[model samples]
Target chain A: MTMIVKKTTQLIAGLIFLYGIYVIIHGHLTPGGGFAGGVIIAGSFILLILAFGSDFLRLTREEAGSTLYENLAILIVVFLAVSGLLATGKIFFLNWIPKGTPGELVSAGILPLYNIFVGIEVAASVLTIFLALVIFKEELAE
Target chain B: METAICIIAGLMIIGALYAIHAKDLLSAVIACGIVGYGLVICFLLLKAPDLAIVQIVVETITLIIMVAVVLDSSREEHFVKPDGKGYMSMAAAVVMTAVLLYFFILAVGMLDPFGSGSLRMASQYINGAVELTGSVNLVTGVVFDFRGYDTLGEATILVTAVLGVITILRLKGRK
Candidate 1:
């Protein structure tokens, strides 16, 4: 990869990730939600990997073990949702906490928590998908 | 109502037929991709982004897998499928798409004799999220909420796909 392509992809990926955060936060008011935003963020990270080199991404993902993160994400979501049910019986998965304030970053209840979880899951899963793909070809030519 | 679906369905079928009839199969794959995109538009109009996203992702994977298979096989003597499509099969495909589209439009359109759905159960979760959970993101609130089971199921599907592929292609060597 030339310096130009590397710089370009990194720039694009960074924009995508920032947009993802914007969407995740204002998700309540916008048509785009956590899932879509999360995907976009993951796409940004993927771009970063493509621009730089798989070596670093591999090191990062290897240390994390995407599968573990994916499983944990599922468990965390389930646990969080169930906790709401047990406490208030508020129709399972209900926020069950205080609305806090409305505009502040931490105003909403469970919104931020799930957003973070989704962010992690999306980052790991998208990388895992690509990692699995590269496995098809024993080695990536630089 | 039914007329528009018929036209859309007709165009889809024509694209597919042309795709198949074309000498090169790669063009046909692209044609199918276009058709898939059209179907996604229809799904969106019906107000189900979930279905639309799922269809697009699934088709993308399918296309990738197909391309991979073709690439692997192209190295060999040749690659092929059924000799040709019978006239009946073509007719059946068009008719089925049209019929299904008609029913779907009718179901989702303003013709649902009854007013908007009760949505009471849905409200319990959506409204509850903001009031109690303090969560600003509703999609997450619901997904991670009581309906978290379905999300887990989706994750399981991914795991299964990975495991299945790993098993099919042993670590010994590339197939």
Candidate 2:
């Protein structure tokens, strides 16, 4: 709540966000995947809220924007899975793209894409819930 | 390793007991978080890094969400005096705990030694995951490829939960 705390949060939030993206992208090779990374990303935003209050972060967008973003991410995931099924003509979620060499970033067909999409959906949903709680608390206090 | 695990498990039990018995709701929530972190340590000791990662993050978020809930409501827990019926229920709980612990120990002993399981399914995944999924991490390969449909189901559940929260929390003209 202090100025020092806000400054420190601002300094570290970027790094935390970057680390979340790294975890999400390198999920295939690392222990952390979409869910974990997404939580971390949401945690960074939570830290911002704690340090500066929700009013400061509410300038970006309202709760509806976050819900829309989450829905879009889930829609992308479903579309990808269905397109894979249609392309392969075998089964849903089939890996139709060419499997690149293992250990490479682009090796896992659809896996990384799925991870990214899930990460987005998770992050958006969590932030939305958090913001909603904050707004509700404010309303109750009023 | 066994001794370390035993110590962690002991701490976990202590944390859980404190969480259940703490008078202050905030302290109880914090104690639950301690138990969650202790389980994460147990997962790491068991060589399940993926589970550990997921557990740690999920535990943190769960703690945050619970704390938010507690913050919005009363902080003091009303203690109920146990009557004769409560004593009987407590006795039954103690017996259940003892029985469950005995069965758990017996099952642990019956399990194959660590790193020595010869399950056919595990072997196939270890041997074929990279070739089949083009991912070096067999866990990821299995989760996102071999069991992609299951992952889809999980994602759907998450979306459903988000929608449910939105619907329940929606306030008129308060976008």
Candidate 3:
């Protein structure tokens, strides 16, 4: 909104986004998962929009991209689940990938993958919602 | 710990009541925010860090959206003088709250003390979950591995919701 606000948001938003990614990646070993981390990621983008103004982001064009990303991410999540079935042929959503030792970064089989994809889907969807609302409000004002 | 939780709950109730009765729409929105944030504190006190993190972020986003809406629209709520029916409703609400509070106290009395909750169905998940799912966090193991289907369904629901929002907000339906 103001120069001071824009500068502060420019500094803080990237750190917020990095924190969201950290939460998503370490979800198997920590408290947050895809949903919480995704929301945080969206929050960072929202802060950017609020600070820099909607015109900076080109809302109409970006809305389409966000919707595409949201749909694609969810599709990949479903594919991952089906892949579990294909891997073992016993049941759906099976942990078919090899499980490394617990507490390690690459430990949870298919869990971290789910977290990452879900995180993407959630972040995209939330960003889409905010963008849609803002664009709608702008159209109404016009 | 119980005392702290109880105090926060009390504050939440007060905030909620103020939000309902406040004349200024923006003030009401802020008072409502107080309730959401108070729940975040309660979630932390109850040892559910996951719930706390989600609640806090969601609450902040919700507050931002609500404040934006209120600021763009009307700031003041039209006040109607309370008549007999309004007074009657207030009395009824008070009575209902008291009854609910009594039952809540009874339920809290029966609960296990703080940090000693019985994991009735969760013990199985806790026992061999790390070995079975290879995730250090049992919540993630249970959510993504044991209850993967449920999470998928939730994600689908979110997709459907976003689709609805986008569809409704689209200016041109067919174009």
Q: Per-residue alpha-carbon lDDT of model 2 for A4-87, expressed as tens digits? A: 999999999999999999999999887888888888898898888878876723623667788898899989999988988789
Where is model 1 more than 4 Å wrong at Cα? A1-4, A49-64, A85-94, A101-108, A139-142, B1-26, B39-146, B163-175
Tens-place lDDT digits, model 2, residues B33-106: 98899999899989999889889988998898899799879999988899999999999999999999999999
Name the DockQ score for candidate 1: 0.30
Candidate 3 residues lying further than 4 Å off, grouped into runs, are B81-119
Say which prediction, candidate 1 or candidate 3, comes out ahead on lDDT: 3
The digit string of per-residue lDDT tens for model 3 on A1-142 reads 7899999999999999999999999999999999999999999999998888888238888888999999999999999999988887768898989999999999888999999999999999999999989988887767
Model 1, docking class: acceptable
Q: Can you give the DockQ of every candidate in the order shown?
A: 0.30, 0.72, 0.86
For candidate 3, write residues B43-152 as lDDT tens digits: 88888999899999999998999999899899989888999999999999999999999999999999887577487867788898999999998889989999998999
Please, what are the lDDT tens digits per residue for candidate 1 over residues B1-175?
Answer: 4455566677788878877676666666767776777777666766666556546655654565455555644433344553457667878899999999999988777553543555668778756766544545455556655566676566557556655654553344433
Ordering by TM-score: 2, 3, 1
Question: Per-residue lDDT for B169 in model 1?
Answer: 37
Descending-DockQ candidate ranking: 3, 2, 1
